[model samples]
Target chain A: MSASDPAGAAAGAPAVAIEQLRKSYGPITALDGASISVDTGEIFGLVGPNGAGKTTLIKAICGILKPDSGSVSVLGLDAARERHAVRRRLGYMPQTPALYEDLSPRENLVFFGRGFRTSGLSDRIRDVLEFVELWERRDDPLHNFSGGMKQRASLACALLRDPELLILDEPTAGVDPTLKQNFWRRFRELKERGRTIFVTTNMMDEALHCDRVAVIRAGSVLITETPEAIRARGRTRVTLGLRDGSLREQEVLAYEEEMPRLLAAYGLSDEVARISVRRPSLEDVVLGMIAGDAGAGEKPAHGGAHGGAHGGRTTGAHPGAGADAEDGGNV
Target chain B: MFSNINAIAVRINRQFLRDRRFLGLSLIVPVLLMLLLKYVLDSLPGLARLGVHISDYAILVAAYLVHFLAYVLSTIVLVRDRKDGTLGRMFVYGYRRREIVLGYVGGYSTIAAVQTALVLILTKYLFDINLAPDLIAVVLTMLALAVVSVGLGVFISNFARNEGQVFPFIPLVIVPTALLSGIAIPIDELPRVLQWCSYLIPLRYAVSVLDGVLNQHRSFFSELGPFLTLVAVGAGLLATASLTLRERE
Candidate 1:
């Protein structure tokens, strides 16, 4: 139940549970039985490359796109069957800052805030505006604002309802690193307040901000794991500085065990003056999983990646295996 | 639902107000068009001599102006909304298709009222017209046409993918309206087929109502048949718009 718990699996249904989703557009299938589970009060990331079904998955969860099969349950209610109920309980921020650019940030917030009967909406507007740090320029029209400012305003609108779950699609795609960091900061704040966030981001680095991330590619999820766990699966790179001034580099897996063996070879030898171990980044781990899944035909195309994968699974192959898919079949 | 609709309406109003150029132009264009109608009718003093009431033609022209402006503006604006994802955003924010449609109509209704009044006032002053005794009714009819035009605009916008796509529809609607709404020429003078087609045009009802009030000297209340037809067409178009509008992003 604490904020540190990524699963948030304490006495409540998972915040979002999507199962066996299959969506297609003509020759392209955006989601091929992609199943993902996000626990309550957690920040979940759906990471992938462009045209990786990330947007489709987000839309299905929001009940904006009816899945051809399977189910999307938000706060335990069927997303399609009870869309209005699910909609009332969740706030969605699309990839682009979908707002009236002519209106000021404050005006946008007020307009969106009116949809929900928030108690003391004016106070709530002030709070969200200040939270997004757009209160000072509240009346300045949005078109005049930079990309980052518009994003902050969009975030303010999405946060206005104070819904139990917030679904964001590429909330930080085009913003600068500082703004991206700022958005994540606000997301964490919302999570700390016991709100569940389901974020779809194509940027692998952004995945580091999520408590748990699901790596998807070509309408299929390849793996779901914490950033740390994914990174651990990546082989560490070891560099050795020898007395002869000749350097040696090696990719070592299970470095905890390999490091000792590697150092022992140089033990009692002045030839090995120094050593450096470069751990794999979370991005490498995730991209490896996505690429590995494409190579491993062993994984069924329709099979959902529901916590059932590792960073690398291509030791077994049918390289470039799954049916070719690109993201747009939005009905 | 009411709250959501109200919010959308208020937001639309705010956005419309900010675009002072469009707002000012939409209101002024109808009045300006009315003045042009006056000059054209005056130049046809021979028509008045031919036992034709030129004032009646002026009001029909005014009605056509109201419909054209409301239709064009609503279509272009809604197409932008759809293209820019505003409508889709509203859908994700829990607003229903019907609510969005009604909200948009409600939003434009206020502006249409102002436009309608402006055009009617100027039409009254610029030419010899008999809308004064029933000025309220005349305004209501014009406002009703504009609202229906808004609904029809929204409905047409659903078929368009972008603002450019919205223009092709203009000729589709305006041509039939001009030829079949009994405006440019009397429906009865046309072929029997085109006359039957006039009944299908919403503008025909508005034109019929105006003609009755101005030439036939029928009181606004007595022209209930065409007046109610106009209202019914508006309801149908609004409903059709709600149905056609995308429920998914």
Candidate 2:
């Protein structure tokens, strides 16, 4: 956010850059030419429904899966060719628990800490456990932990190294709302410290917390832009109530220039008893893209060469260039 | 690499110690089986004309039983870790395949050592077997067998899909190999083909080395060939295991 901005720290090298990544299993294509770039110190969110290839993309970036034909570079190093080096700079929290239920949280941290060869491991573990608010239950075996507690412990494992980039896959799934809020706060704090975070979530509301969001569906990223840009893809809806108990709703562009003309056209400028205007949420924006893609009968070349080229150097892009907001259905 | 291996080894040891059922199975079950064998052999009416010493047979059987136990324990632990994604998580954390394999070997080898010592001590005092003068040779032979068992367990775990798959391997691998290793009869006394097949079994060398020290009173130097063969087989199996291990199936 300032002179120490991670985006400016390395002018040319993006924190994560993927181009034309494709992966498959037999006949099922898990990822189809998905490409995106996450800038340094940015909280980039991958928002999509289940089976949208969010996990696949995260795995490819973490070097856990080798893409069939693509290039993935983390911190300017090839992820597949230089896996260990890339992994050393990353902390990944998998979708599943992927933990030793038999071992205590403290023991789990010790095991993973040694794998990363972390220095001052004890202090780091304690710090992360406290940060996740799991320090009091650190000695309990993970089997005894609730779903959210297990998730926090898993996050603590990734945080032990204080990595330069953290890749989390659905970190807030099944987590209580309070803990979910805490996680976002911690992510923001990490961003302030110049660490980048790449996270995936199906919860549309969660996208608001990220600096940028990539809307993916069925293995293809539909659009990648800032949260504000995504929200702007939906028009503001105005609800009008008449004196006779009749109700009518209308959609208008977000700009104020259209408001008065629309009100006059409805002949409700003086007769309207009540009026309310609300903008579309992220869910609306994603649903609009999905519906548009379905109607076009052709997949929007989301994050292709142009998207990739633009995404590489810029943090904010106009929503019109990607998905047309006027085409988005009524809010 | 060394530190990662050491950490994994320590973690594995703690897991084994915490699992009371596994501890009992690995340590107590074999001794109990040895006791049952001792009683059964003692009950049999055998004269001096037969020239079969029940105590010597007890030592051989005890060694084989303990060796097989080590195999089962190590395979179950390794396979469980793989199935649960713990090993995969470690890989994502930058731990290499060989480090994980070596960690397993180092950890289970500790269990093997304790197992060998416990079984030998229990059999020696419980059955009053005359094993004092050549105790070190016998212990060395058992320790060698333990190493081979650990290696075999880790290698076999790669082929198993789950814990249930591991059980079938015992009859297919351990039982046949133990039978051919002359646990019941001399390999040379079998037919020529069977005798030749015994050469392929590492346990044959282990049984031979143990027999020489405990029954034949041979020096460790005299049985050095079989001992070295055990160590070499262990190294080979471990290398293969490490190469076969993958993050996913």
Candidate 3:
């Protein structure tokens, strides 16, 4: 495989590398020795809960926020001292919508395009707007656009100069699911075009799209691995669904040593379903780790944003539970 | 550097055209204030209890308008941009903090220069106010006033959290400067203590420079000390503003 090719699994030179990053906001530590590297053309995902220092880390790398101690290098340039050159090669979409709301989408794109000093900027603006599929509404006031459209426009503005690196913070948080799917497709297309991207998302399912995932908690990274690696290390998960749905709540309440036995007595066997509980999901893994849950086998309930069961096909059961055992709520 | 400057100018002008309130301040507010200045200067004979020509007040008003326009409008626009995150956004896009400051100066300076032209043209042609001895000196003084006003705007914007906080500071700077800068209340008649207080205002130096240039027709160098002093004050404020940007970083 060629050096520039992104398809190869082996890591080449990292496009962006950070080491021993430390930052603090008064008494609260924002990043504690957080380090990660994004290889050339790889679409990396930084996964973490809120206040997990994801933004802090991104800001430090972007030179907008300074870390108390650490080093960040982008494409082999110092992030702090060489910020302008680094910025020249990167497109950043902040968590908050940073476009001028009063300006039309076209005007906003042109404005940011000018900032990047892109040659044939007007044409580049047109191409980016079309790429984001927002060309038709280019003349619409940004304030009038819906959340998803506004996000697409923001993406367009960031892509005005087609920088090599893209840093997006929850780029699809408020976007509708259909548009989000489209966004992921666009991200893959950009990845194919040899652009490196570092994205932060709380959406667990989106983790599957990333080449690698770094799960962070509090002010430190919990783990970083490929999606398959994370899933392969996944412990047993037996999501019990009761006919009445009331017994499941009580079973969760009596969840110490008794819940497992109760689950097994009802034919919820380990050989069949990999019982004895397991390490929680990406979200639970971080929260449980924060709560000092020891990463041991514990069937922590999944909540927050994933209220749906089975890919939007909703069922009247506790969230994320897949099993249906009716005889006095098997497990 | 120039390309960066062009980018900043585009953003500033885009903002100027898009925000209705800013547009009004840039175009209409200055014209209206010119008329108001004409009226107030016309009424000064009766109000001041001193025999002062509307023409004399007109010269002072021309100079003061430069100050007023620079202070009021620059404060509003700069403060709005800061509160709305435009200043922070500017830094993210390869712009030096100094470039942002100077680009705003360049954009607002263009606005002030054009408005100064109209005010002077109206005062000379429409109002029949005779030309002063040193027209270039007067123009340079007005330019200095513009610089001082914009510098003060950037300085004040650093402290203002939002548009609401910015509004209250307008009176804090404008009221005292107007009263003491020989615009309304002549500085000579005020007590010695208040006279010293007036000296602290950058506009006081601006008005003195204009007074020497237009009223006395002195060479610009005759009033060079105060002119350069005002420039220094403006530069000091701008430097402070650039330093405070570290907080945002």
Q: lDDT by residue for model 2 over A175-227, one digit each (tens)?
A: 86557656877787787788889999987656656788898887888899987
Residue A279 lDDT, candidate 1, scale 0-100: 29
Question: Going through the candidates in order, what is the number of backbone clashes in each?
Answer: 0, 0, 0
In CAPRI terms, model 3 is classed as: acceptable
* Winner on lDDT (2 vs 3): 2
lDDT ranking, best first: 1, 2, 3
Instruction: For residues B1-249, write the lDDT of model 3, one tens digit per residue.
Output: 777777676667676667787666666766787788767666656755765556666766776777777777777777776665455556666677777777777778877887888788777865686666567776777787787788788777777777788888888887888788877888999999889998778878877877776667677888999888888888887777666654344
Error of 3 at B56 (Å): 2.6
**In candidate 1, which residue pairs clash?**
none
Better of 1 and 2 by DockQ: 1
Whole-model Cα lDDT of every candidate shown, in order: 0.77, 0.77, 0.71
Query: What is candidate 2's lDDT per residue for B37-116, written digit by digit as tens?
Result: 77787778673349877777777887787678778888987888777767768988878988988898889889888877
Top TM-score model: 1
Candidate 2 regions off by >4 Å?
A: A1-9, A26-28, A228-266, A270-331, B43-51, B190-196, B247-249
Instruction: Give the chain A TM-score for each candidate.
Output: 0.77, 0.78, 0.71
Candidate 3 lDDT, A4-26, residue by residue in tens: 33332234668888898999998
- Candidate 1 residues A1-331, lDDT tens each? 1122332334667888888899988788899989898989888999888899999998888787967788888888888888877777788888889899989988777776666565677877887888889999999999999998888888888878777888999998778644665687778778778889999887655565677989988888889998656655767577889999999899886555565567777774545433332222333344436656433333322222221121222221221111111111111
